[model samples]
Target: MNSMPKYLLMALALISLIACKTSQVSTTPSPAAGMFKVAILYPNGDDKTFDMDYYEKKHMPMVAGHLGSNLKFYEIDKGTAGRTPADKVPFVAIGYFYISDVAEYNKAIAQNRDAIIGDIKNYTNIQPVINISEIRQVVGNNTK
Candidate 1:
């Protein structure tokens, strides 16, 4: 049987996730109920090299290009260690992209699904854990 490409599958899943409880875009980590996107990438087995440069320079730009305005503030976290120093990190990196609404973000990804999925190869070989979730600002800025 013919199966959809992995990236396409990931895109479809992301779209579905957004549709169910979808959107908010912000620079802060505050969870705004129905508006946030979080994508995490894990290392594919023993592969040690994760091209951080390409991810920042090439892959993300391609994603932003297609996502356009729907793409709000986003963050990338490169894992250095787990809860302790000895334990290895579960995932290599994480991406958090916020948008105005779920439906709009879903539409944006659906339209540029191919390009977005295809660009994954430029970064890592592992399949990322993509999740659409609500952003809740548990703690406000303490500096103020």
Candidate 2:
């Protein structure tokens, strides 16, 4: 019984990784001026596992709902490969959020922290590396 969740998690992870082909290129509109960026990177590890299906279908939507209007945009990226051919996939996945108000975002996160943190176990076991930054530049096609 205990193994069932683990098996499902593993299967979801494998399917996600396989579906995101490394050779493909994707583009998103450049962040608007002054937007704050929040990056949540789930580093890969020997024992770490992630269920992308749960994260994409359930967890992220829940978070967006919790965040409400403060969150302008968000994306969930499945790590396919590293920069070099020999390098390992650095992160299992990454969640990116573009927000308008830092204070409001913080407040929302604080209010929903328990529910958000509690759901982590359903999708992933790794601790994510989080970075909040100011969008400084935009150079690519500003289109989706």
Candidate 3:
């Protein structure tokens, strides 16, 4: 029996957690209901280092290229401060991509898993929390 690759397995696990939640915040209005969303959260800590420059400039573009047309779009959130001035930051950075199809995403991941997984070391050592979800609704200024 062939077991799933470690990276793919982890992605599947994270995707199952929030299959119906919105992770993107924008004025472009929601990209229709049931949109597949992938969110990667890099949890912050006392000794962690996340190279924002590399992530924003290099890694994400590589991801987008690999994701190709199935990737509707993506967003990145850089942590500035916590809930309050004295609190610790929850995450160093968060990367979210609105995928057009889950199956295609999986297929792409299967082919490029090594390249994607291997690039993590260039930016941060922290294991990111991945969430694959669906957009249920859009509230606030984003709603139609």
Name the top TM-score candidate: 2
- Model 3: which ten-residue window has the lowest total lDDT? 20-29
Candidate ranking under lDDT, highest first, comes to 2, 3, 1
- Cα shift from native, residue 30, model 1 (Å): 6.8
Off by over 4 Å in 2: 1-30, 141-144
Give the per-residue lDDT digits (tens) of candidate 1, residues 28-130: 5444555666565655347655777888788776776766776776777887788899888877777777776778778888998888888787778777777
Model with the higher lDDT, candidate 1 or 3: 3
List per-candidate RMSD values in Å. Answer: 20.6, 17.1, 20.4
Model 1 Cα displacement at 73 (Å)?
A: 0.8
* Superposition-based RMSD of candidate 3 using all C-alpha atoms, in angstroms: 20.4
Which candidate tops lDDT?
2
C-alpha TM-score for every candidate: 0.68, 0.76, 0.75
lDDT of 2 by residue, 1-144 (tens): 999999999999998888887747787645887899999999998999999999999999999898898888899899999999898999999999899888998999999999999999999999989999988776767798
**lDDT scores in order:** 0.72, 0.91, 0.88
Q: Comparing candidate 1 with candidate 3, which one achieves the higher TM-score?
A: 3
Error of 1 at 23 (Å): 32
Name the lDDT value of residue 103 in candidate 2: 90
